[model samples]
Target: MVQAQVTRREFLKASALVAAQVTCGAWLTGCANALAASAPPPAASDAPAPIATPTLSRELPFSGWREVKYYDQLASAVVQCAQCPRRCVIAPNARGFCQTRENRDGKLYSVVYGRPCITKTTPIEKAAIYHMLPGTQSYSLGTAGCNLACLYCQNYTIARAKPEEVESYTMTPDDVVAAALKAKTKSITFSYSEASVAFEWMMDIAKVARAKGLKVILKTGGYINEAPLKELCGALDAINVDMKGFSQTFYDQVCQGELKYVLETIKTIRRENKAWLEVANLVVPGYNDDPKMIGDFCAWFKENLGDDVPVFFTRYEPAYRLRMPPTPVETMERTYKIARDAGLKYAYVGNLPGHTGANTYCPKCGKLLIERVGFDIKQNQIAKGKCKFCGETINGKWA
Candidate 1:
């Protein structure tokens, strides 16, 4: 691993950086180094996780900025973005809260459309999606800027930075598809920062990914408006929505977001029945870890998402503004029990490798279905979407 890491700063010597070895922003060499160098050290928490780098490059054209498709122009050169539930009303020359969308004159343009700071190839399991193409590779990418203000964001190095603050690449949708193909990945994933913040790039890549018979997956906070989400779902094959917490108070205090909007986002995606959906709750200690709150969360999840949709209660590590200790394994176990007790068919735990909670068990015959070691699959007992032991029908898009 002594080889030079690819970042927008030193890697852009010519053009066309490889998709597998590029990291984002300044801190990422692009974001990891550049942003981390100038960014103030977190006075409250440990440093955020490093953005992994991708590799290779070819010169591609940068489009400056792409005009967004969802927005409403108002009088006096103001516009309201319809992309996320925030619906930021931006003035002329102003930017949205995500800092990736700007109102230039009267039109809203996506500033991070083709200028991702990172595009590393990883396993689909890292996307927190276990039901689809287990063990298959996923080509992932992310840009700077995030919509919500999560106090414990793990990738805050890129999430808190602006596109201008980071070194970026001119990766078009076709370029992304070509890279994914070169990497021999089964899906193209949008992750790292709030993927929806770079909605245009994701959508364009999804279209090309689909035409080329590659799956499209998303790891999102699910804080999006109804209309734009439906269109996004049309191309997405799988989605892992981060259900921050179950209560409104948690959202208000920790994330500075509305619980209602995220709830609607989940419902809209499920109701649309387009993408295979999974939910993850990062178990932040003492914040969203109350037993009663977890029970309520599971009950609501069972009622709304039913039995098939996989749910995860993952561990939270200290990062960004929040300096809480890593979530206890006991707490993770507690949430998993609560989810299963509420009659959920599929419940898993993450951020802890070698834990049995990471394995997939059959809801019907109580058989071990998929054994996973971190993001790697050890043994897959479920075959052809059915449990090998009991022939029970499993709910997932099997490879």
Candidate 2:
């Protein structure tokens, strides 16, 4: 199938038009129409093909290797990946734990650069980032790897596979920005899988999106090193970090990661204060649903990330390697109360549609500010980022 490449000139024109619309307070209807009209149509033979199932294939394309940053070359044709805490020491022609970065003749390169296995325009809430751009759509995409090995990964089909094992479409940074503009989305998100595995691709696309006055949101697992995490925070407008569980033992056994690094990543984001930060913790039954553990988690969250930061206690379903039953609704309710009692203003229970906990309320007056059912926003009472009833300032990006 033929692929269309967007030229730099076309990107600049599209970005300029979007900027003008934002400045003049014009509706996105005209801007979207302009972008669609200017964009080149797909050739008749270039219709998108169905995505392939993940399987080992030697014939898959593997030529897209771009030099990676934040790595140290070691002796005897070995390299250490500094992108994440894993710090995988890969020998020549070997791959890191993520399986997306490889060592080619002692040089670490990203094999999934500009090759996205999934792309769609989805509600921001679906990313579990309930605060930023609440009701708006975000152009979301992800590559085919993850830094962690979570046993119950929902997207394990691609996240657990090697880059060459999945079918992907090549999209440059300009192509991604153009697609977002054409879709009439004001933000771009790197989601679905562990986006930290495709750090280079996301960073490049974020740079272009930022220049076009579009926000960049990362729905990540928060497993990166300090240096790279700080660098990524520079271009990010918002982030929703998944905090899996509270115990170090749980992390080591279930996620193949450590609790300290994830906490440090959250701390780094809060310290930088450059992006809107939100956190979610999936409550697995009989695992992390202990009342004491929940309370401890909430207390630590309140102390480290502050009480204003939104925290979500989501129900976990059986998937991947885990055979556990779905979390009980009562467990989620209890966890929500625990978070609220810990002084968190916006504590929520996710994965249970139509629950009262899904709505955002005013912390001071206890007035319902945003009414939501699942990912859809039914009513929003917060105007100009302030509670309409008590006129108290809400902590989020609302326009």
lDDT of each: 0.83, 0.83
- For candidate 1, lDDT tens digit of each residue in 136-235? 9888888889999899998888889877776666667877787677667888999988988777888888998899999999999998877778988887
- Model 2 Cα lDDT, one tens digit per residue, 1-399: 999998865654555454434422222443544456657866879633222111222222457668898899989999999999999999999999999898988899998888776767788898888777789988888888899989989999989988778766567788778777766787988987888777888888889899998999999899999998998889899989999999998898799999999999999999999988999999999888999999998889988989999888999999999978899988988999888888899999999999999999999999888999989999999988899999999998875
How accurate locally is residue 50 in candidate 1, as Cα lDDT from 0 to 100? 37
Estimate the lDDT of model 1: 0.83
Q: List the lowest-lDDT window of 10 residues for candidate 1.
A: 19-28
RMSD of 1: 9.9
Clashing pairs in 2: none
